[model samples]
Structures are given as structure tokens and as C-alpha cells.
Target chain A: MLLTALFVIVCVALGAGVGIYTSRDYTASNAVKPAVEGFLWPNPRIIQPFSVVDQHGNPFGLENLTGQWSFMFFGFTHCPDICPITLSLLSQVQKKLAEQDTADKVQIIFVSVDPKRDTPEQVADYVSYFSKNLIGLTGTEEQIAGLARQIGVVYIVNDETAPGDYSVDHSASVFLISPAGQWLGLFSAPHEVDDIINRFNTISEYIKKQE
Target chain B: MRYSSGFLFFILIAVQSVFAQNSIEITDVWINEAPPTVKILAGYFTINNHSDDPVDLVTAHSPSFQKIEFHLTETQDGVARMQKLETISIPAQSDFSFSPGEYHLMLFNPVKTTKAGEMISLQLTFSNGTNIDVEAEVKRSELPPHHHHH
Candidate 1:
């Protein structure tokens, strides 16, 4: 009887050891995801439904963001310095991604905060100057406010005497939206092309591995 | 041979100084090519003071625009805001760089169509009553010749 009890104890110890070892191995192989750089969200924020119009006068919403990554900036075409500069930097980013043959995986979107002045035709023309691949979006005040509010972007129209001589102060950071239309992270202003491309490639590789 | 090369290097440095020894030198001057309907355009440049005395930029006038103001874009707590400045002081033997997202010139009410590759002349008035004329080319791009800071 004592020998049988000893055999049972040995069996229980071996079973527990095997179970713990397998669980650890499973976690190492599957549970861990590669970490991203500064300002990456471990859990992407769910983007709510929004309706707007693209520069081509086509309906654009969260659905448009489906199946591709997007780097979105909020500014107006009238913004001379930062807006064009940011768009130019994004074009460089897109160029690098294109060299890697991953350009189709992502897009650059410029959303106008000054819808009162930035018409569809004007936006289309402005964005096309940057790159044909760049998309421009504008909409009714409410539609724009809803999307900007959800994304935590703020724009204030500065009061000036001259009618089109004013400037709209908006958030300068570029947000990275995931393929599933979730807010993944953001790259702040004073942006560099290499830094943005590197961060994007790292994130893309990690996402591909997860799939 | 090493002594001769060193002398050549000294001569090169002297030549560079001869070109840069002016009291106020403008470099990296550029302006954004505004859209047709937009009245206000932004301009950026850097001013280096090689003279022994400080220079105060008291007034700025651009023939292309009706009025010009020294403006600064300040991002505080993730919000970008611009404020007008009456004057900007440049210390002696120092440099003041006005680039995107920093000090800039806000040109209001363009007198005519300002296209890219066009030149706009600006007359700067110093506190000491010295006037400097700077010509800035209207260009559009995010990446300047120099790398971005931070």
C-alpha cells in the first residue's frame, strides 16, 4: 500500500511539472507581441463611426480606413508653413515605404480644420500638389467637429480683421491609424522622415507577424 | 608640406570670415507659396550677427504684402498658438533662426499673386536705424536643408 501511494505522489508531481512547462512555452511562443517605440498604444483605441467627404467629393468615413494604415494630419490649406512641411515630410515617408513595396499598405490623409475656407476643389488641388497619393478630407462643421473631437484634435479660429487673412491653430501631431480603423499611436511635430519610417516599419512588421 | 597645408586652411578660414563678417547676414530665407485665395503667407529665415554690437529688429516691411508682423508659434501642452511680437532682439555675435513652428513673419494681404519660385523683398529696420533688405524665395517643403531639432 505504501509503494502505491509513493507512485501516485510521483505521478502528480510529474503532471504538475509538465503542465507548468507547457504553459510557459505556450506564452513565450504566442502571447508576447513586439513592443513599439515611444507613444505607441498597447491597446488601440476604438474609433467611432464618422462621416466626412474626401477631396474628390466622395463619401469618406471610418470605413475608408479599413484594410489599410493611415497617417492623418489636421490643418488647413491656408496654413503655409507647418502644413506643407508636414505633408512634405509625409511624402518622404511614403517614398521610403514605396521603395520597400509597402506603400499600398498605408496612406497619408490631410484633414482641413478650416472647412469654411477650404472647399472640396481647393483641398483637392492643395493635396495633389503634395502627392497624388495623399488624400484631402473636409466636411460640414458638425461632421468635422465630431471626428476631430473623437481624435482629440483641436482647432481655434483666430479673430482677425481681414476676412481670409486669419489662421487656424490646430494640433500639429500626426496620428497613426491602424488597418482596423483604430487609433494606434501618434508622431509628434518637428517630425523627421527617417524616424517616422522606422517606427512605421517596425509596427508593420510586428502586425504582420501577429497575423 | 604640412605647414603649407595649415596655412592654406587658415587662408580658407579668413576668406570665409571676410564674406561673413557683416553686421547682419540673412541665411536660409524661404516663404510658403500660398494658395490663390489665401491672403496671409508665412516666411522663415535666420539672421546671424557677426558684428560686435547687438541688433534689434524693430520693424519689417514686405512689398508683396500690405503689412508684416513678427509672429511666433508656441506649442504649450500640445496646443499650438501664435502671438505677435513687436520686436526681436539679436545679441552680439549670435544667431536667431526663424523656421517653421518657431519665429516667423506673417505677411498679410498680398498685393499680387505670389507664386512659387518668385522672390519677395523685405526691408528690415534695426533699432540703431540701420536698414537691411532681405530677399526670400517663395518655396514649399517640410524638409529644409538642415535637419530638424527634436
Candidate 2:
């Protein structure tokens, strides 16, 4: 009976040790894995303060991005193909969230790289076609570049073939910012509705666990 | 034997002409309707060449727009750059699609504001002296409506 008792004790201690060791190993590996796909979890970049104007001609800076998730896309109103497709996808994302009664948690922002042509009034009219809740932003060339550079957005204004007619080559990725106003990460081109929502949910859950 | 061979040649020629007659086909022609304030729009379609000879799409024109050009949107290193394509050559017995984020017909300066469901006429010219007339319907971006899960 003593031998059996000792055997039981030894097995229990070994099982507990194995359990602890495996869990520590699992966590060590998971620490390096990204929180979610397309999310910069370990070190989300801090967004610097910059001045720009919203669709209403009101000054919008990093403060406007606080307290809500922001999905920002960089494009010009003159972009015929990719811009519209991306904006429409974002609208669907907003609509899906709204259906879940979580619409207030996020905001969609369209930043025009072609500030010379995209005036406040023009942006106002352009965004309304996609969604009434969408926020359009444009500023002077230098001001726009300041924010774009910080966010790693690259854009170039092409030479005009005719007067007032030109194209702007800009990044097609959609940048994600947390409610804390940190640059979370980006969703690359060819974004789908469900894929974004799924990743957003995964990131949100991960963040909740962190808190 | 000479007369029989001549008859066979005539039959082969007739069959080949029939194949050439129904070689080039354009399908899924549609244009994304833009806001009235926007001057540029994009059109998408698929061209299928069933003939043995390759077809080169040289240029396109539209009566509803001031200018139409073949523009290719290429995304490299996260940057989306657009270039004007002078001609798009489709190999024989192959299909080419001008879809979103790829090759598109860049329509500029619409003569009038076009709404969804409106029809626009386009004339696509080929290097082989063939012109194809297409009627493209204007469509809003196709996003699924809110799901009603009971």
C-alpha cells in the first residue's frame, strides 16, 4: 500500500510539472506571433499630431481619431477604379458593423492625397455618395504629406497631360488605427468584407485580453 | 481526283470563315457609376478570342464620355500606379478580363451624369480593322446588403 501511494504521488507531481512546462513553452512561442493577422500588436506605432481639415472645413488632427477605431484609405477623388472599389468595400464593412449594432465603435476616413484638386467642398460631395457617415480629409500639400509620411503612405502627383488633368499614385492599403490613436497596422489591397471583420474581431478580442 | 480535291478545299474554306465570323466575343460589360461631381469613371469587361489569330485591342471611344483610354492599375509594394495602355493583345483562344484593381477603361468627362442602370455605348477598335460595339450598363459597386439572420 505504501508503494502504491508513493507511485501515485510521483505520477501526480510529474503530470503537474509537465503541465507547467508545456504552458510556459506555449506562451513563449505565442508571444512572438502577431495578435491577429495584419495587426501590429507588440508595438503599435504612436500617431503624431498633425493638422488637417475635415470634410466640413474643420481642423482635424490626431484628436479626432481618438475614442473610435479608424480605417483610413489614401486616394484621390479622380481615381476611377481602385478608390471606388476600396471605398465601397469599406462602406460594406461599416454597414455590417451597423447591423451588429456596433457601428459607433468605428469610423471610416478618406484622405485625399491630391489636395490641390480635392477641396473641402469637393470632398464633402464625394464622400456623401459612398456613406453619409464617412469622413473626408484634405489639407495643403505639406500638411497632407506630414501625416502621410508618419503613416508610411507614399503618393506621387503625376505630370498633367492637360491643364488640371492628372493622376495621383498612392498606396492602396487601408490603415487601421486603434481608439488609442496608435497606428495598428494595415489591410492590403483586395480587401474583402468578411476577412476584415474577422481580423478586426480577433484583434479586438486580443486587446481585451491584454487589458 | 482534281475535282474532288477542289471541292474539299472549298468546304474547308467555308468552315474556316464560319469560325472566324464568331471568334471575338465581349461579355460582362459594365461601368461603375461615379458621383456627379467626379469626372472619371471605370468600366470592366471580359474579352474572349476564340479564333486562331490573336486580337489586339487598339483603342476605345465612347459617345457619352469626352475621352476613353485603356488604363491598367498595377499595385506594387503597396503603391497603386496607373499606366495608359496603348494596346492590349489577347492570345488566340484565350480570355482577358478587365476587372477591379486591374485593366480598366478609364472614362473621362462624362457628357452627362449617369445613374445606375443607365446604358452607355462604347466602340472598341482593334488592330485588325475590326470594330466591336458594346452597350455597357452603369452599376453601383456591388456590396451585399445587410444580412437578416433570424
Best lDDT among the predictions, by candidate number: 2
Candidate 1 lDDT over A1-211, as tens digits, reads 9999999999999999999999989756753555655446567777898999999899999999988999999999877667877898898888788888664588999999999888889899888888899999999989999999988888898886464557788998898988988787777777788888888877766666566
Pairs with backbone N, CA or C atoms under 3 Å apart (clashes), candidate 1: A85-B142
Q: Which residue segments of model 1 deviate by more than 4 Å?
A: A1-35, B1-21, B35-37, B142-150
| lDDT (10s digit) by residue, model 1, range B51-149 | 788988898898789998898887765667778899999999999988887788888889997888999999888886777788999986547445635
Each model's DockQ score: 0.37, 0.58
Total backbone clashes of candidate 1, pairs 3 or more residues apart or in separate chains: 1
Best by TM-score: 2
lDDT of each: 0.83, 0.89
Model 2: per-residue Cα lDDT at residue A155: 98
Q: Best DockQ goes to which candidate?
A: 2
How well does candidate 1 score on lDDT at residue A11?
Answer: 100
TM-score of each: 0.80, 0.85
